[model samples]
Target: MLSLGAGVQSTALLLLAAEGVLPRLDGAIFSDTGWEPEQVYVHLERLEKEVATPAGIPVYRVSAGNIHTDALDPAHRFASMPLFVKNGDGSVGMIRRQCTDEYKLKPIKRQVRTLLGYPAGRLPRGLFAEQWVGISCDEFTRAKDSGIGYALNRHPLLELGWSRTDCLRFLARRGWQSTPKSACVGCPFHSNAQWRQMRDHQPTEWAAAVAFDHAIRSGAARGNATGSPLLGQAYLHRSCVPLDQAPVDTVTAHEWRERQGSLLDLLDPEDGPRGCSPWTCRSDDHDAESAVAA
Candidate 1:
Protein backbone atom coordinates (compact mmCIF):
# COMPACT_ATOMS: atom_id res chain seq x y z
CA MET A 1 0.00 0.00 0.00
CA LEU A 2 1.13 3.56 -0.69
CA SER A 3 1.03 6.15 2.07
CA LEU A 4 -0.68 8.77 -0.04
CA GLY A 5 -0.11 12.29 1.24
CA ALA A 6 -1.74 13.78 -1.89
CA GLY A 7 1.27 16.07 -2.19
CA VAL A 8 3.53 16.29 -5.26
CA GLN A 9 5.81 13.38 -4.48
CA SER A 10 3.11 11.04 -3.25
CA THR A 11 0.78 11.94 -6.08
CA ALA A 12 3.57 11.25 -8.53
CA LEU A 13 4.11 7.89 -6.92
CA LEU A 14 0.44 7.00 -7.22
CA LEU A 15 0.33 7.98 -10.87
CA LEU A 16 3.50 6.06 -11.56
CA ALA A 17 2.01 2.98 -9.97
CA ALA A 18 -1.17 3.41 -11.99
CA GLU A 19 0.89 3.77 -15.16
CA GLY A 20 2.73 0.54 -14.39
CA VAL A 21 6.07 2.25 -13.85
CA LEU A 22 6.17 0.97 -10.29
CA PRO A 23 4.85 -2.26 -8.89
CA ARG A 24 1.08 -2.36 -8.59
CA LEU A 25 -0.13 -1.26 -5.20
CA ASP A 26 -3.05 -2.73 -3.29
CA GLY A 27 -4.30 0.77 -2.58
CA ALA A 28 -3.32 4.18 -1.20
CA ILE A 29 -4.07 5.22 2.35
CA PHE A 30 -4.52 8.88 3.32
CA SER A 31 -4.31 9.73 6.99
CA ASP A 32 -6.27 12.89 7.41
CA THR A 33 -5.46 15.29 10.25
CA GLY A 34 -8.71 17.15 9.55
CA TRP A 35 -6.89 20.51 9.53
CA GLU A 36 -5.26 20.24 6.10
CA PRO A 37 -5.50 22.99 3.52
CA GLU A 38 -8.64 22.83 1.37
CA GLN A 39 -6.59 22.13 -1.75
CA VAL A 40 -5.27 18.86 -0.36
CA TYR A 41 -8.74 17.38 -0.02
CA VAL A 42 -9.76 18.63 -3.46
CA HIS A 43 -6.69 17.10 -5.01
CA LEU A 44 -7.37 13.81 -3.26
CA GLU A 45 -10.89 13.73 -4.67
CA ARG A 46 -9.61 14.45 -8.15
CA LEU A 47 -6.95 11.79 -7.85
CA GLU A 48 -9.56 9.26 -6.84
CA LYS A 49 -12.21 10.18 -9.40
CA GLU A 50 -9.85 10.95 -12.27
CA VAL A 51 -7.05 8.43 -11.75
CA ALA A 52 -7.29 5.84 -9.01
CA THR A 53 -10.86 4.78 -9.78
CA PRO A 54 -10.17 4.31 -13.46
CA ALA A 55 -7.01 2.36 -12.63
CA GLY A 56 -8.87 0.15 -10.10
CA ILE A 57 -6.72 1.28 -7.21
CA PRO A 58 -8.69 2.09 -4.08
CA VAL A 59 -7.95 5.16 -1.96
CA TYR A 60 -8.71 4.97 1.74
CA ARG A 61 -9.40 7.97 3.96
CA VAL A 62 -8.98 7.45 7.66
CA SER A 63 -8.70 9.71 10.67
CA ALA A 64 -8.21 9.33 14.40
CA GLY A 65 -9.92 12.63 15.20
CA ASN A 66 -10.15 16.25 14.22
CA ILE A 67 -6.91 17.89 15.29
CA HIS A 68 -8.29 21.42 15.31
CA THR A 69 -11.25 20.50 17.51
CA ASP A 70 -9.27 18.22 19.81
CA ALA A 71 -6.83 20.97 20.68
CA LEU A 72 -9.61 23.27 21.80
CA ASP A 73 -11.76 20.76 23.72
CA PRO A 74 -11.23 21.32 27.43
CA ALA A 75 -12.15 17.74 28.33
CA HIS A 76 -9.86 16.21 25.72
CA ARG A 77 -6.29 15.24 26.45
CA PHE A 78 -5.04 17.12 23.45
CA ALA A 79 -1.88 15.79 21.93
CA SER A 80 0.51 18.71 21.72
CA MET A 81 1.55 20.16 18.38
CA PRO A 82 5.01 21.61 17.90
CA LEU A 83 3.69 25.06 18.57
CA PHE A 84 6.10 28.00 18.87
CA VAL A 85 6.16 29.35 22.39
CA LYS A 86 7.38 32.65 23.81
CA ASN A 87 8.67 32.49 27.35
CA GLY A 88 8.59 35.30 29.90
CA ASP A 89 12.32 35.93 29.41
CA GLY A 90 11.72 36.63 25.71
CA SER A 91 13.23 33.36 24.57
CA VAL A 92 11.57 31.28 21.90
CA GLY A 93 11.04 27.50 21.97
CA MET A 94 8.45 24.86 21.00
CA ILE A 95 6.07 22.47 22.66
CA ARG A 96 6.81 18.81 22.01
CA ARG A 97 4.84 17.43 19.08
CA GLN A 98 2.61 14.36 19.42
CA CYS A 99 0.04 15.15 16.76
CA THR A 100 1.76 13.14 14.05
CA ASP A 101 1.83 10.04 16.20
CA GLU A 102 -1.72 10.48 17.40
CA TYR A 103 -3.50 11.93 14.39
CA LYS A 104 -1.45 10.55 11.47
CA LEU A 105 0.59 7.47 12.22
CA LYS A 106 -1.74 5.73 14.63
CA PRO A 107 -4.78 5.88 12.40
CA ILE A 108 -2.82 4.73 9.37
CA LYS A 109 -1.35 1.86 11.34
CA ARG A 110 -4.76 0.78 12.49
CA GLN A 111 -6.00 0.76 8.92
CA VAL A 112 -2.98 -1.21 7.82
CA ARG A 113 -3.68 -3.82 10.45
CA THR A 114 -7.28 -4.03 9.36
CA LEU A 115 -6.21 -4.47 5.75
CA LEU A 116 -3.88 -7.25 6.83
CA GLY A 117 -6.90 -9.12 8.20
CA TYR A 118 -5.82 -8.87 11.80
CA PRO A 119 -7.68 -7.48 14.75
CA ALA A 120 -6.45 -4.30 16.43
CA GLY A 121 -3.67 -4.69 19.04
CA ARG A 122 -3.26 -8.36 18.22
CA LEU A 123 -1.24 -9.09 15.12
CA PRO A 124 0.13 -12.59 15.05
CA ARG A 125 3.79 -13.26 14.29
CA GLY A 126 5.26 -13.28 10.75
CA LEU A 127 2.75 -10.85 9.27
CA PHE A 128 3.87 -7.69 7.47
CA ALA A 129 2.90 -5.25 4.74
CA GLU A 130 5.12 -3.51 2.20
CA GLN A 131 4.29 0.14 2.76
CA TRP A 132 5.42 2.56 0.04
CA VAL A 133 6.57 6.06 1.01
CA GLY A 134 7.24 8.98 -1.37
CA ILE A 135 10.66 10.21 -0.32
CA SER A 136 12.50 11.35 -3.47
CA CYS A 137 16.21 11.12 -4.30
CA ASP A 138 17.08 14.65 -3.14
CA GLU A 139 15.50 14.01 0.24
CA PHE A 140 16.76 10.48 0.70
CA THR A 141 17.59 11.18 4.33
CA ARG A 142 13.92 11.26 5.10
CA ALA A 143 13.51 7.61 4.11
CA LYS A 144 13.24 5.58 7.28
CA ASP A 145 12.32 2.16 8.61
CA SER A 146 8.68 1.52 9.54
CA GLY A 147 9.70 0.98 13.21
CA ILE A 148 6.86 -1.54 13.55
CA GLY A 149 7.38 -5.13 12.52
CA TYR A 150 4.02 -5.33 10.72
CA ALA A 151 4.94 -2.73 8.13
CA LEU A 152 8.09 -2.43 6.03
CA ASN A 153 8.81 0.98 4.47
CA ARG A 154 9.65 1.26 0.77
CA HIS A 155 10.77 4.27 -1.29
CA PRO A 156 9.92 3.82 -5.00
CA LEU A 157 10.78 7.44 -5.82
CA LEU A 158 14.38 7.08 -4.66
CA GLU A 159 14.68 3.80 -6.48
CA LEU A 160 13.57 5.57 -9.68
CA GLY A 161 16.19 8.31 -9.16
CA TRP A 162 13.51 10.97 -8.90
CA SER A 163 13.68 14.25 -6.98
CA ARG A 164 11.13 16.85 -5.97
CA THR A 165 11.90 18.73 -9.18
CA ASP A 166 11.39 15.56 -11.20
CA CYS A 167 8.04 14.96 -9.49
CA LEU A 168 6.89 18.51 -10.28
CA ARG A 169 7.96 18.23 -13.88
CA PHE A 170 6.22 14.89 -14.28
CA LEU A 171 3.00 16.27 -12.81
CA ALA A 172 3.19 19.43 -14.89
CA ARG A 173 3.55 17.44 -18.12
CA ARG A 174 0.37 15.60 -17.09
CA GLY A 175 -1.43 18.97 -16.62
CA TRP A 176 -1.38 18.90 -12.81
CA GLN A 177 0.49 22.17 -12.41
CA SER A 178 -1.11 23.61 -9.32
CA THR A 179 -0.39 20.84 -6.83
CA PRO A 180 -0.18 22.42 -3.37
CA LYS A 181 1.93 21.04 -0.57
CA SER A 182 -0.26 18.93 1.71
CA ALA A 183 -0.22 20.06 5.33
CA CYS A 184 -2.43 21.11 8.17
CA VAL A 185 -3.64 24.67 7.80
CA GLY A 186 -2.28 25.72 11.19
CA CYS A 187 1.09 24.00 10.85
CA PRO A 188 3.70 26.24 12.48
CA PHE A 189 6.29 25.05 9.97
CA HIS A 190 4.61 27.07 7.22
CA SER A 191 6.94 29.56 5.54
CA ASN A 192 6.13 33.17 4.86
CA ALA A 193 5.17 32.40 1.27
CA GLN A 194 2.76 29.60 2.26
CA TRP A 195 1.11 31.75 4.90
CA ARG A 196 0.79 34.63 2.45
CA GLN A 197 -0.78 32.33 -0.15
CA MET A 198 -3.29 31.10 2.41
CA ARG A 199 -4.14 34.63 3.52
CA ASP A 200 -4.45 36.02 0.02
CA HIS A 201 -6.03 33.14 -1.85
CA GLN A 202 -7.72 30.99 0.79
CA PRO A 203 -9.33 33.48 3.10
CA THR A 204 -11.69 31.04 4.84
CA GLU A 205 -8.88 28.64 5.72
CA TRP A 206 -6.71 31.58 6.68
CA ALA A 207 -9.35 32.79 9.11
CA ALA A 208 -9.65 29.36 10.67
CA ALA A 209 -5.89 29.15 11.07
CA VAL A 210 -5.79 32.57 12.71
CA ALA A 211 -8.59 31.61 15.08
CA PHE A 212 -6.82 28.39 16.02
CA ASP A 213 -3.63 30.33 16.66
CA HIS A 214 -5.47 32.61 19.04
CA ALA A 215 -7.15 29.69 20.77
CA ILE A 216 -3.86 27.94 21.50
CA ARG A 217 -2.21 31.04 22.96
CA SER A 218 -2.82 29.81 26.46
CA GLY A 219 -1.82 26.27 25.45
CA ALA A 220 -4.07 23.24 24.96
CA ALA A 221 -7.54 23.69 26.45
CA ARG A 222 -6.96 20.60 28.59
CA GLY A 223 -4.11 22.36 30.29
CA ASN A 224 -6.56 24.88 31.65
CA ALA A 225 -9.03 22.15 32.68
CA THR A 226 -6.34 20.25 34.57
CA GLY A 227 -5.36 23.36 36.53
CA SER A 228 -1.84 23.34 35.06
CA PRO A 229 -1.64 26.05 32.47
CA LEU A 230 1.22 26.44 30.08
CA LEU A 231 4.34 28.23 31.23
CA GLY A 232 4.52 30.24 28.01
CA GLN A 233 2.15 31.34 25.29
CA ALA A 234 1.79 29.44 22.02
CA TYR A 235 1.67 30.90 18.53
CA LEU A 236 1.23 29.30 15.13
CA HIS A 237 3.62 31.75 13.49
CA ARG A 238 7.26 31.37 14.37
CA SER A 239 7.49 35.07 15.18
CA CYS A 240 5.78 34.17 18.48
CA VAL A 241 2.92 36.50 17.65
CA PRO A 242 -0.70 36.13 16.60
CA LEU A 243 -1.22 34.56 13.19
CA ASP A 244 -3.17 37.53 11.78
CA GLN A 245 -0.32 39.83 12.70
CA ALA A 246 2.51 37.59 11.54
CA PRO A 247 5.09 38.76 9.00
CA VAL A 248 3.68 36.57 6.23
CA ASP A 249 3.92 39.29 3.62
CA THR A 250 7.65 39.80 4.14
CA VAL A 251 10.11 37.66 2.16
CA THR A 252 13.45 36.86 3.75
CA ALA A 253 16.74 36.58 1.86
CA HIS A 254 16.79 32.81 2.25
CA GLU A 255 13.30 32.53 0.82
CA TRP A 256 14.26 34.78 -2.07
CA ARG A 257 17.15 32.52 -2.98
CA GLU A 258 14.98 29.45 -2.74
CA ARG A 259 12.48 30.97 -5.13
CA GLN A 260 15.32 31.80 -7.52
CA GLY A 261 15.75 28.08 -8.21
CA SER A 262 14.43 26.85 -11.54
CA LEU A 263 10.65 27.34 -11.76
CA LEU A 264 10.10 23.81 -10.46
CA ASP A 265 12.18 24.21 -7.33
CA LEU A 266 9.54 25.94 -5.27
CA LEU A 267 10.97 24.95 -1.90
CA ASP A 268 9.46 26.29 1.30
CA PRO A 269 12.14 28.06 3.39
CA GLU A 270 10.89 27.08 6.83
CA ASP A 271 9.63 23.54 6.26
CA GLY A 272 11.86 22.55 3.35
CA PRO A 273 10.22 21.52 0.07
CA ARG A 274 8.25 18.39 0.97
CA GLY A 275 4.98 18.35 2.89
CA CYS A 276 4.29 16.39 6.04
CA SER A 277 3.89 12.61 5.64
CA PRO A 278 2.43 10.25 8.21
CA TRP A 279 5.80 8.61 8.84
CA THR A 280 8.15 11.48 8.01
CA CYS A 281 6.87 14.75 9.41
CA ARG A 282 8.36 18.07 8.27
CA SER A 283 8.78 19.06 11.92
CA ASP A 284 11.61 16.52 12.19
CA ASP A 285 13.99 19.34 11.29
CA HIS A 286 12.67 21.67 13.98
CA ASP A 287 13.97 20.47 17.33
CA ALA A 288 11.27 20.35 19.97
CA GLU A 289 11.70 22.22 23.27
CA SER A 290 9.66 22.10 26.45
CA ALA A 291 8.77 25.76 26.39
CA VAL A 292 5.04 25.35 26.94
CA ALA A 293 5.21 22.99 29.88
CA ALA A 294 2.16 22.61 32.07
Candidate 2:
Protein backbone atom coordinates (compact mmCIF):
# COMPACT_ATOMS: atom_id res chain seq x y z
CA MET A 1 0.00 0.00 0.00
CA LEU A 2 1.45 3.36 -1.09
CA SER A 3 0.01 6.36 0.79
CA LEU A 4 0.27 10.07 0.28
CA GLY A 5 -0.83 11.28 3.69
CA ALA A 6 -4.37 10.44 4.86
CA GLY A 7 -5.96 10.53 1.44
CA VAL A 8 -9.22 8.65 1.18
CA GLN A 9 -8.54 5.66 -1.05
CA SER A 10 -5.26 4.66 0.62
CA THR A 11 -6.71 5.17 4.08
CA ALA A 12 -9.64 2.95 3.25
CA LEU A 13 -7.26 0.31 1.92
CA LEU A 14 -5.31 0.41 5.18
CA LEU A 15 -8.51 -0.07 7.18
CA LEU A 16 -9.69 -2.93 4.99
CA ALA A 17 -6.30 -4.59 5.16
CA ALA A 18 -6.13 -4.43 8.95
CA GLU A 19 -9.67 -5.82 9.27
CA GLY A 20 -8.68 -8.88 7.23
CA VAL A 21 -10.71 -7.82 4.21
CA LEU A 22 -7.63 -7.86 1.94
CA PRO A 23 -5.80 -10.47 4.12
CA ARG A 24 -2.21 -9.91 3.08
CA LEU A 25 -1.30 -6.24 3.36
CA ASP A 26 2.43 -6.83 3.37
CA GLY A 27 4.20 -3.62 2.34
CA ALA A 28 3.20 -0.05 3.19
CA ILE A 29 5.21 2.55 1.35
CA PHE A 30 5.47 6.35 1.12
CA SER A 31 7.20 8.45 -1.55
CA ASP A 32 8.47 11.62 0.14
CA THR A 33 8.89 14.30 -2.56
CA GLY A 34 10.96 16.59 -0.30
CA TRP A 35 8.48 19.50 -0.63
CA GLU A 36 5.45 18.11 1.20
CA PRO A 37 3.66 20.37 3.66
CA GLU A 38 4.88 20.52 7.26
CA GLN A 39 1.45 19.30 8.39
CA VAL A 40 1.80 16.19 6.24
CA TYR A 41 5.20 15.41 7.77
CA VAL A 42 3.69 15.78 11.24
CA HIS A 43 0.77 13.54 10.41
CA LEU A 44 3.05 10.88 8.83
CA GLU A 45 5.05 10.77 12.09
CA ARG A 46 1.90 10.34 14.13
CA LEU A 47 0.66 7.67 11.75
CA GLU A 48 3.96 5.80 11.76
CA LYS A 49 4.27 5.88 15.54
CA GLU A 50 0.72 5.10 16.57
CA VAL A 51 -1.06 2.95 14.02
CA ALA A 52 1.40 1.79 11.35
CA THR A 53 4.00 0.69 13.93
CA PRO A 54 1.55 -1.20 16.12
CA ALA A 55 0.19 -2.99 13.08
CA GLY A 56 3.64 -4.56 12.57
CA ILE A 57 3.59 -3.48 8.95
CA PRO A 58 6.84 -2.15 7.54
CA VAL A 59 6.20 1.30 6.04
CA TYR A 60 8.95 1.62 3.46
CA ARG A 61 10.45 5.07 2.96
CA VAL A 62 11.02 5.49 -0.80
CA SER A 63 11.88 9.14 -1.06
CA ALA A 64 13.49 11.36 -3.70
CA GLY A 65 15.65 13.13 -1.12
CA ASN A 66 15.87 16.14 1.23
CA ILE A 67 18.19 19.14 1.51
CA HIS A 68 20.09 17.80 4.54
CA THR A 69 20.37 14.17 3.49
CA ASP A 70 19.79 14.19 -0.24
CA ALA A 71 20.44 11.21 -2.49
CA LEU A 72 20.97 12.50 -6.05
CA ASP A 73 18.16 14.96 -5.20
CA PRO A 74 16.77 15.68 -8.63
CA ALA A 75 15.23 19.07 -9.28
CA HIS A 76 11.90 17.68 -10.50
CA ARG A 77 9.35 15.80 -8.41
CA PHE A 78 5.97 14.38 -9.57
CA ALA A 79 4.18 17.60 -8.74
CA SER A 80 6.75 19.98 -10.09
CA MET A 81 6.40 19.16 -13.80
CA PRO A 82 3.53 18.58 -16.19
CA LEU A 83 3.59 15.61 -18.53
CA PHE A 84 2.37 17.44 -21.61
CA VAL A 85 3.12 21.01 -22.53
CA LYS A 86 0.30 22.45 -24.61
CA ASN A 87 0.96 24.66 -27.58
CA GLY A 88 -0.29 28.23 -27.61
CA ASP A 89 -3.20 27.07 -29.73
CA GLY A 90 -4.23 24.65 -26.94
CA SER A 91 -2.92 21.62 -28.78
CA VAL A 92 -0.97 19.01 -26.84
CA GLY A 93 2.74 18.60 -27.41
CA MET A 94 5.42 16.36 -26.00
CA ILE A 95 7.67 17.68 -23.24
CA ARG A 96 9.99 16.09 -20.76
CA ARG A 97 7.89 15.36 -17.67
CA GLN A 98 9.40 12.42 -15.87
CA CYS A 99 8.84 13.56 -12.29
CA THR A 100 6.43 10.74 -11.53
CA ASP A 101 8.58 8.21 -13.35
CA GLU A 102 11.66 9.38 -11.44
CA TYR A 103 10.50 10.30 -7.93
CA LYS A 104 7.45 8.11 -7.44
CA LEU A 105 7.18 5.19 -9.84
CA LYS A 106 10.79 4.12 -10.42
CA PRO A 107 11.84 4.00 -6.78
CA ILE A 108 8.69 2.17 -5.78
CA LYS A 109 8.89 -0.42 -8.55
CA ARG A 110 12.58 -0.97 -7.81
CA GLN A 111 11.87 -1.62 -4.14
CA VAL A 112 9.04 -4.00 -4.90
CA ARG A 113 11.00 -5.78 -7.57
CA THR A 114 14.03 -6.12 -5.29
CA LEU A 115 11.86 -7.74 -2.62
CA LEU A 116 10.61 -10.12 -5.30
CA GLY A 117 14.22 -10.99 -6.24
CA TYR A 118 13.92 -9.49 -9.72
CA PRO A 119 15.41 -6.05 -9.04
CA ALA A 120 15.91 -4.72 -12.56
CA GLY A 121 16.45 -5.65 -16.24
CA ARG A 122 14.37 -8.80 -15.84
CA LEU A 123 10.88 -9.79 -14.69
CA PRO A 124 10.28 -12.43 -12.05
CA ARG A 125 8.99 -15.37 -14.05
CA GLY A 126 7.71 -17.13 -10.94
CA LEU A 127 6.72 -14.37 -8.51
CA PHE A 128 3.07 -13.38 -8.35
CA ALA A 129 2.85 -10.80 -5.57
CA GLU A 130 0.16 -8.14 -5.91
CA GLN A 131 1.20 -4.49 -5.74
CA TRP A 132 -1.78 -2.46 -4.60
CA VAL A 133 -2.63 0.98 -5.94
CA GLY A 134 -5.17 3.31 -4.27
CA ILE A 135 -7.16 4.53 -7.25
CA SER A 136 -10.83 4.95 -6.34
CA CYS A 137 -13.92 3.65 -8.11
CA ASP A 138 -14.16 6.80 -10.16
CA GLU A 139 -10.56 6.56 -11.30
CA PHE A 140 -10.54 3.04 -12.68
CA THR A 141 -9.90 4.34 -16.18
CA ARG A 142 -6.45 5.47 -15.15
CA ALA A 143 -5.77 1.90 -13.96
CA LYS A 144 -4.06 0.18 -16.82
CA ASP A 145 -2.10 -3.01 -17.29
CA SER A 146 1.11 -1.05 -17.71
CA GLY A 147 4.07 -3.09 -16.52
CA ILE A 148 4.59 -6.77 -17.13
CA GLY A 149 6.76 -7.97 -14.26
CA TYR A 150 6.71 -9.82 -10.93
CA ALA A 151 3.66 -8.37 -9.22
CA LEU A 152 0.14 -7.91 -10.48
CA ASN A 153 -1.69 -4.56 -10.16
CA ARG A 154 -4.43 -4.49 -7.56
CA HIS A 155 -7.10 -1.84 -6.99
CA PRO A 156 -9.13 -2.68 -3.89
CA LEU A 157 -11.10 0.54 -3.68
CA LEU A 158 -12.19 0.28 -7.29
CA GLU A 159 -13.13 -3.36 -6.88
CA LEU A 160 -15.11 -2.64 -3.68
CA GLY A 161 -16.97 0.32 -5.26
CA TRP A 162 -15.87 2.64 -2.44
CA SER A 163 -15.61 6.36 -2.99
CA ARG A 164 -13.38 8.81 -1.16
CA THR A 165 -16.08 9.31 1.47
CA ASP A 166 -16.08 5.62 2.38
CA CYS A 167 -12.36 5.83 2.94
CA LEU A 168 -12.69 8.88 5.24
CA ARG A 169 -15.49 7.27 7.27
CA PHE A 170 -13.27 4.26 7.90
CA LEU A 171 -10.43 6.50 9.04
CA ALA A 172 -12.66 8.50 11.37
CA ARG A 173 -13.88 5.23 12.92
CA ARG A 174 -10.25 4.49 13.77
CA GLY A 175 -9.86 7.94 15.40
CA TRP A 176 -7.30 8.92 12.80
CA GLN A 177 -6.64 12.53 11.90
CA SER A 178 -7.09 13.76 8.33
CA THR A 179 -4.26 15.80 6.93
CA PRO A 180 -3.99 17.86 3.75
CA LYS A 181 -3.81 16.08 0.39
CA SER A 182 -0.33 14.68 -0.25
CA ALA A 183 1.75 16.46 -2.88
CA CYS A 184 4.75 18.76 -2.80
CA VAL A 185 4.23 22.14 -1.11
CA GLY A 186 5.19 23.80 -4.39
CA CYS A 187 3.34 21.23 -6.42
CA PRO A 188 2.05 22.39 -9.76
CA PHE A 189 -1.09 20.33 -9.14
CA HIS A 190 -1.94 22.58 -6.14
CA SER A 191 -4.97 24.79 -6.49
CA ASN A 192 -5.06 28.41 -5.44
CA ALA A 193 -6.36 27.42 -2.01
CA GLN A 194 -3.58 24.91 -1.37
CA TRP A 195 -1.04 27.42 -2.56
CA ARG A 196 -2.48 30.03 -0.24
CA GLN A 197 -2.21 27.60 2.65
CA MET A 198 1.51 27.27 1.98
CA ARG A 199 1.97 31.02 1.63
CA ASP A 200 0.12 31.73 4.86
CA HIS A 201 1.19 28.88 7.15
CA GLN A 202 4.62 28.17 5.64
CA PRO A 203 6.07 31.47 4.60
CA THR A 204 9.62 30.21 4.29
CA GLU A 205 8.70 27.37 2.01
CA TRP A 206 6.51 29.60 -0.07
CA ALA A 207 9.31 32.14 -0.35
CA ALA A 208 11.84 29.52 -1.28
CA ALA A 209 9.56 28.20 -4.01
CA VAL A 210 8.94 31.69 -5.32
CA ALA A 211 12.65 32.50 -5.47
CA PHE A 212 13.50 29.14 -6.98
CA ASP A 213 10.90 29.82 -9.64
CA HIS A 214 12.13 33.35 -10.27
CA ALA A 215 15.67 32.09 -10.63
CA ILE A 216 14.56 30.13 -13.66
CA ARG A 217 12.57 32.75 -15.54
CA SER A 218 11.69 30.81 -18.68
CA GLY A 219 11.01 27.08 -19.09
CA ALA A 220 14.29 25.60 -20.30
CA ALA A 221 16.15 28.73 -19.31
CA ARG A 222 15.84 27.82 -15.64
CA GLY A 223 15.96 24.06 -16.15
CA ASN A 224 18.54 22.14 -18.09
CA ALA A 225 18.68 21.81 -21.86
CA THR A 226 15.04 22.90 -22.17
CA GLY A 227 14.04 26.29 -23.40
CA SER A 228 15.33 29.33 -21.52
CA PRO A 229 12.30 29.90 -19.24
CA LEU A 230 8.60 30.59 -19.55
CA LEU A 231 7.27 33.93 -20.73
CA GLY A 232 7.02 35.59 -17.28
CA GLN A 233 8.79 32.55 -15.90
CA ALA A 234 7.01 29.66 -14.21
CA TYR A 235 6.05 30.06 -10.57
CA LEU A 236 5.05 26.97 -8.60
CA HIS A 237 2.07 28.76 -7.05
CA ARG A 238 0.42 29.29 -10.45
CA SER A 239 -0.82 32.84 -11.17
CA CYS A 240 2.48 33.12 -13.16
CA VAL A 241 2.78 36.04 -10.78
CA PRO A 242 5.00 35.75 -7.77
CA LEU A 243 3.66 33.86 -4.73
CA ASP A 244 3.63 37.02 -2.61
CA GLN A 245 1.79 38.80 -5.38
CA ALA A 246 -1.06 36.33 -5.43
CA PRO A 247 -3.81 37.23 -2.93
CA VAL A 248 -4.84 34.52 -0.53
CA ASP A 249 -8.54 35.22 -0.72
CA THR A 250 -8.51 36.16 -4.35
CA VAL A 251 -11.81 35.28 -5.94
CA THR A 252 -11.74 33.27 -9.13
CA ALA A 253 -13.07 35.04 -12.18
CA HIS A 254 -16.01 33.36 -13.91
CA GLU A 255 -13.86 32.65 -16.93
CA TRP A 256 -11.14 31.16 -14.76
CA ARG A 257 -13.70 28.87 -13.14
CA GLU A 258 -15.04 27.75 -16.48
CA ARG A 259 -11.60 27.06 -17.89
CA GLN A 260 -10.48 25.28 -14.73
CA GLY A 261 -13.66 23.24 -14.62
CA SER A 262 -13.20 22.26 -18.22
CA LEU A 263 -9.68 21.12 -17.53
CA LEU A 264 -10.83 19.03 -14.60
CA ASP A 265 -13.50 17.51 -16.78
CA LEU A 266 -10.90 16.53 -19.30
CA LEU A 267 -8.94 14.67 -16.63
CA ASP A 268 -12.05 13.15 -15.04
CA PRO A 269 -15.57 14.48 -15.29
CA GLU A 270 -16.32 13.29 -11.74
CA ASP A 271 -13.55 15.09 -9.90
CA GLY A 272 -14.72 16.26 -6.48
CA PRO A 273 -13.41 17.31 -3.05
CA ARG A 274 -9.78 16.55 -3.95
CA GLY A 275 -7.77 15.70 -6.99
CA CYS A 276 -6.22 12.23 -7.35
CA SER A 277 -3.03 11.51 -5.41
CA PRO A 278 0.26 11.56 -7.29
CA TRP A 279 0.55 7.81 -6.90
CA THR A 280 -2.69 7.15 -8.78
CA CYS A 281 -3.14 10.20 -10.97
CA ARG A 282 -2.20 9.59 -14.60
CA SER A 283 1.10 10.97 -15.78
CA ASP A 284 -0.87 12.80 -18.47
CA ASP A 285 -3.10 14.51 -15.89
CA HIS A 286 -3.00 18.33 -15.73
CA ASP A 287 -6.00 19.26 -13.59
CA ALA A 288 -5.35 21.74 -10.78
CA GLU A 289 -8.85 22.14 -9.38
CA SER A 290 -9.49 21.30 -5.71
CA ALA A 291 -12.05 21.21 -2.84
CA VAL A 292 -11.49 24.82 -1.85
CA ALA A 293 -14.86 26.57 -1.65
CA ALA A 294 -14.84 28.88 -4.59
lDDT digits (tens) for residues 94-140 of candidate 1: 89889999999998898999999984777888899999999998779
Report lDDT (Cα) of residue 36, candidate 1: 90
Model 1 CA deviation exceeding 4 Å by range = 266-272, 284-294
Best by TM-score: 1
At residue 243, candidate 1 shows an lDDT of: 87
Per-model TM against the reference:
0.92, 0.73
Give the Å error, residue 282, model 2: 6.8
Clashing pairs in 1: none
lDDT of 2: 0.55
